[model samples]
Target: MPGIAVRTAAVLLVTVGDGTSFPTAAHLASYAGLAPTTKSSGTSIHGEHAPRGGNRQLKRAMFLSAFAALHDPASHTYYDHCRTRGKTHTQALLRLARQRINVLFAMLRDGTFYEPRTPRLT
Candidate 1:
């Protein structure tokens, strides 16, 4: 929601179409091609990789939103955390997009608005 503007929101609404098509956020992420897929065969299992399928428009919207969200402190922190965890720049952005999809799903499901989390002082 941080980076989602009029055009982005329009694209998302047009692409997702009522949100009933996806049962869960995971389903939405998969549809948008943000969910990583695991490739395996016998004992020689391949690692998770970005899938080459799904709605390209939705994927592009999510990806661009994630990139634009980097300006938000929370989003920037998450991106940095992903980078520290050894995720590539693109991978981190994809992960962020997936994370945002979960939030979007919850918002759509509950008809709620975005509320930024406040950092707890410890």
Candidate 2:
């Protein structure tokens, strides 16, 4: 109302986009610039970098959401999986954001809100 980061607003906006039960998690992630960037040249090359273009506020919101994902067993497990697979903190967070996007997509498509399903520990 008074003052809030644009990222926060973006997340909320995406969550409520169109009111058709679709929030465009994928769109939100891309908008936030949380997606990875790749650069290659004749010789020199950069593997990946934080995305170059997107809404900074959305990026900040997604990053902030990463912390919350860390504490959730389901989300944390996925987050750990990304890290274990050789992703850095930033990379892992991006992966988590992507995962979150998928979840949101599914929810929107199915008309369901998040209800994390945790796998049984073996």
Candidate 3:
């Protein structure tokens, strides 16, 4: 939600409607084309690749949000973790977007707003 401007949020609301429509976050990601497509052939695994079909506007919103989230401490840490794992910049961003979708899904299910961090007590 950090990177989601009003316009983007509006677009997402219009395109995605109710999050409950999706059984899970993964389903929502697939609907938005954030999930990878499998490519296996001839008894060999060609590996997974970006999906070719999904709601373009939703995907765009997620991608942009992920990009903007880099400024967030947690998001920055996750992005760096992906980079350390040898994920390319684009791959890391996509991973971030997917993670965000999962969080969004939970938030919608619980009717909660984004929280930057959990409270801690000593």
Q: Where does model 1 exceed 4 Å of error? A: 41-44, 118-122
Residue-level lDDT of model 1, residues 8-115, one tens digit each, is 999999998778888999999999998889999989889998999999999999999999999998888889888999989999999889989988998888889998
Q: Give me the candidate number with maximum TM-score.
A: 1
Please report the TM-score between candidate 1 and the true structure. Answer: 0.90
Give every collision pair in model 2.
7-57
- Each candidate: what lDDT? 0.90, 0.63, 0.88
Q: Which of 1 and 2 is ahead in TM-score? A: 1
Residue lDDT tens for model 2, 6-122? 666566566446335425655655666765667889888889777779876556665667666587777688777777888888778777766665555566567775675873323
Candidate 2 — worst ten consecutive residues by lDDT sum? 1-10
Q: What's the CA error at residue 43 for candidate 2, in Å?
A: 13
lDDT of 3 by residue, 25-101 (tens): 99999999999989988899988899989999999899999999899988888888889999999999998899889
Q: Itemize residue pairs with steric clashes in candidate 1.
A: none
